[model samples]
Target: MPAVLGIEVKLDPKWSIVSTPLFEAYWFTDGLNSGRRDELYSVDVGLRYSFASNLSLTNTVLYEGRTSNVAIRHYRDLRIGPRLDFAF
Candidate 1:
């Protein structure tokens, strides 16, 4: 990791984070010449609210791609998730 002297500013009234950054990549090798085939970055974003008691839902989308040291190359992957919850 590389670090330097830097500063930033934050100006917001209401802020919330529903998703976290997660990265996954794979490498292929055949005796020599290693190459990356599958690379993916996933995150979830949603809000939670109480219906009448203990109940909630979640929704998220994932992005998958194939990348290299030179170029991101080509990527075609899309995913979505929608769920509901109920209490008795």
Candidate 2:
């Protein structure tokens, strides 16, 4: 099963904050890892500024991690960047 939670809050007319969190589970049914389960978690949070109705910029922070019964599958990562979005 996979699940997600998201929220957005407007801070005045041109600025906003947004976040999305997610979780997923994976089951291995065959091979050497049979009957093993892995869990994944991730989230993205951003501050967005709108220049116009069709254009916006967002600075975001992202984190992703995974855990499994197998030690080799455990890992985590963090990322930060700016994203530009436009619609026509």
Candidate 3:
């Protein structure tokens, strides 16, 4: 099963904030990993500024982590980046 929550808030007209949080579960049924279950969690948050209706920039941070019944399958990561969007 997977679940997600997303939100966006407009501050005035040119700036906004966006966030999404997600959770997912995976089960493996046929392999050496049979009857194994893993849970993944992640979230992304961004601050966006619009220069025009067709152009925008966003700075974002993301974090992800996973837990598994198998010890070698657990991991965590953090990422930050900028995104430019244009519609032409």
- Tens-digit lDDT string for candidate 3 (1-34): 9999988899979999988999999999998889
| Tens digit of per-residue lDDT, candidate 1, span 3-79 | 22222222232222245456666566664436645555554454434444556554656555555553655565767
Q: lDDT (0-100) at residue 21 of candidate 2?
A: 97
Predicted structure 1: lDDT: 0.50
**How many times do residue backbones clash in model 3?**
0
lDDT of each: 0.50, 0.96, 0.95
The count of residue-pair clashes in candidate 2 stands at 0
lDDT of 2 by residue, 1-88 (tens): 8999988899999999989899999999999889889999999999999999999999999999999998989999999999999999
List the candidates ranked by lDDT, beginning with the highest: 2, 3, 1
Q: Which candidate wins on TM-score?
A: 3
Residue range with the least summed lDDT across 10 consecutive positions in model 3: 6-15
- Name the runs in model 3 displaced over 4 angstroms: 52-55, 86-88
How many clashing residue pairs, candidate 1? 0
RMSD of each: 8.7, 2.0, 2.0
